[model samples]
Target: MSRPIMSKATALKISRAQFDINKIRFFDFLNYKFRFLFFCWFDLPCYFISKGQYNFAARVACTELSSYAAMYFLARWNFKPTLFVFLLPFAILRLGLMIGNWGQHALVDDVDPDSDFRSSVTLIDVPSNRFYLNDGYHTSHHLNPLRHWRDHPHAFLTAKDRYSNEGALVFQIIDYLEITYRLSTKNYIYLARQLVLIGSQVGMSQEELAAMLRLKTRKFSEKEIAIELKK
Candidate 1:
């Protein structure tokens, strides 16, 4: 059977065209200057609002705020971490989640670059899944946002064959942060070494996997994106 395809990659590419948030400097910019106020007030709303975006907003506010908020109230809370708990959705956590999203959706097949199955990655046996409700199964989330988190492992196992066909990236002993870091540093050898091959991919050599990964991470030209969108 042929691999499954979805238009998410096209949407993701168009979204990424404006910003390369993978850089640590970009991160510094977001972290400094409370620039996120601008994101909250103007940038994001002017751009788009997905439920995931709102979920990210709420999740950051609820999670990080408590720890930071507690610290602030107890002592001389740095005006940065405490008073801005609510603003974390825009600042601290938004920047963080963008890194995760970049890692999750970084690899795109040159021929089928717009296909969700070809673009997103899944990390297995990663600790983040334990803490964040199976967030390692990002490809599954992209496949079906409504699917329960507990069911992701089962879903992935059952559909392993399809995932293999799509050449979907699967990793072990790593999380999105590591993936993002490795990609940013151009560490394809390590990434390929860590990649968990499935089905037809079982025989792929390390060099071949590294080459494929390099191709996956390359930015498609405007003409390429236009052609993919037209498809």
Candidate 2:
């Protein structure tokens, strides 16, 4: 697969910001670049339906509608006075869920993309994990989703070699939100710096590691997903 260089727009964007990551983040916030994606709930039902999963899609659609209806009724049908109040927490929760998922599964290996360890990430020292209860062990969650939260880290440690073989990525002192931001901006240099070398990756150079990470972030086609799923 061909790797993409930064686009002209991206070049201009970085230039305008003087290559500052914080400025890029601020600009992206003003642009609502990820907000639409963060509201993944809005398109999910339609997405499922398009893939010919009518039952699950219908349930999702109906449940979403009913939830909104309940919220509106709770607000006494007053949009200005109370709708924002009701939506405040719900929107926050939804955005968090979507953003976490995005960050978790963002770096799927171009090869072996179907491997759970290869697809999701393990985050250490992320503050939200303490509050959200094991949100940081997303790779282990994907490995066996029903596993109790407390056992997640243990599981990863036990299968450390497998994770290393699958080329799993881990980060310390970085939360999912920052992961999402870094990936969105294609800041591979920063990501390479943060990578926790589990096994085979110990001797890799920053450029080589960045290239691998960049390749993982590329969008897979339906054909690619279908191919991956078969194996």
Candidate 3:
């Protein structure tokens, strides 16, 4: 599969066009620049690290920490009160994670069973309809950040859409979230607390969270499936 690269032209154009001219103060622009530059600097390193190069992981970590430092300096520049307010908790958690030894366990990938030991989705390599945005596995995310695989008709209609057709191993989102969130928030009590708060804010009940966790680790038993079907 062809890997996706965020185009510099696209990034700049989007940044300038989407941003409010009057609203973006000097500090806001600086923060935006910080985020963009950090993304650029770490992009290649992240790819290399994902390829199993330990040295690349170290380099990426170093650069990522530096980028976060830059982001901190530029945070005050942001003028979007609403965005800043919404981002504060996540941002603060991220910054804290970057500092502690717990940073070693930072979660990088999506919460997918297919993502656990390896990738879950298998695609046709023809690259015809694959515009890298709509179909290009990873690039598609850049194009449509919120488009979920489950929402696709081909996948949603079938009992084994991602699992069988795409060669993906489907698992409960709650399961993925619990493991990843716990690992990422290790030693970061504020983040741990924030996670609980976020869970509550999202309207997930404790029973639901436990059920998801159980599903994540438990293999799919035919009996369970039968029981679910009966319900």
Q: lDDT of all predictions, in order shown?
A: 0.67, 0.65, 0.36
Pick the winner on lDDT between candidates 1 and 2: 1
lDDT of 1 by residue, 1-231 (tens): 111222474345533443343333554434433444333334333232332466545544555456555655744646565545544554567667666665776676777766667778888888988988898887887788778889889999999889988778899998998887898787888999898987666888998888888877666677777676565
Model 3 C-alpha lDDT versus the unseen true structure: 0.36
Candidate 3 local Cα displacement, residue 65, angstroms: 16
In candidate 2, which residue pairs get closer than 3 Å at backbone N, Cα or C atoms, i.e. clash?
none
User: Model 3 TM-score?
Assistant: 0.25
RMSD of each: 7.0, 8.9, 17.6
The digit string of per-residue lDDT tens for model 3 on 1-231 reads 222333322322232333332233456545544454446456556655655666756776686677566556566676366346645654565444222211111221223322321121122232322432223132233323345643332432343332333323222212222333443333223222323222122465545544433333323234533433343
Which of 2 and 3 is the better model by lDDT?
Answer: 2
The RMSD (Cα, Å) of candidate 2 is 8.9
- Ordered from best to worst lDDT, the candidate numbers read 1, 2, 3
Model 2 residue runs over 4 Å out of place are 1-65, 229-231
Tens digit of per-residue lDDT, candidate 2, span 23-110? 3455444334344334334555655665586776787668777876788787876766564666777767666755555566567666
Q: Could you tell me which 10 consecutive residues in candidate 1 have the lowest summed lDDT? A: 1-10
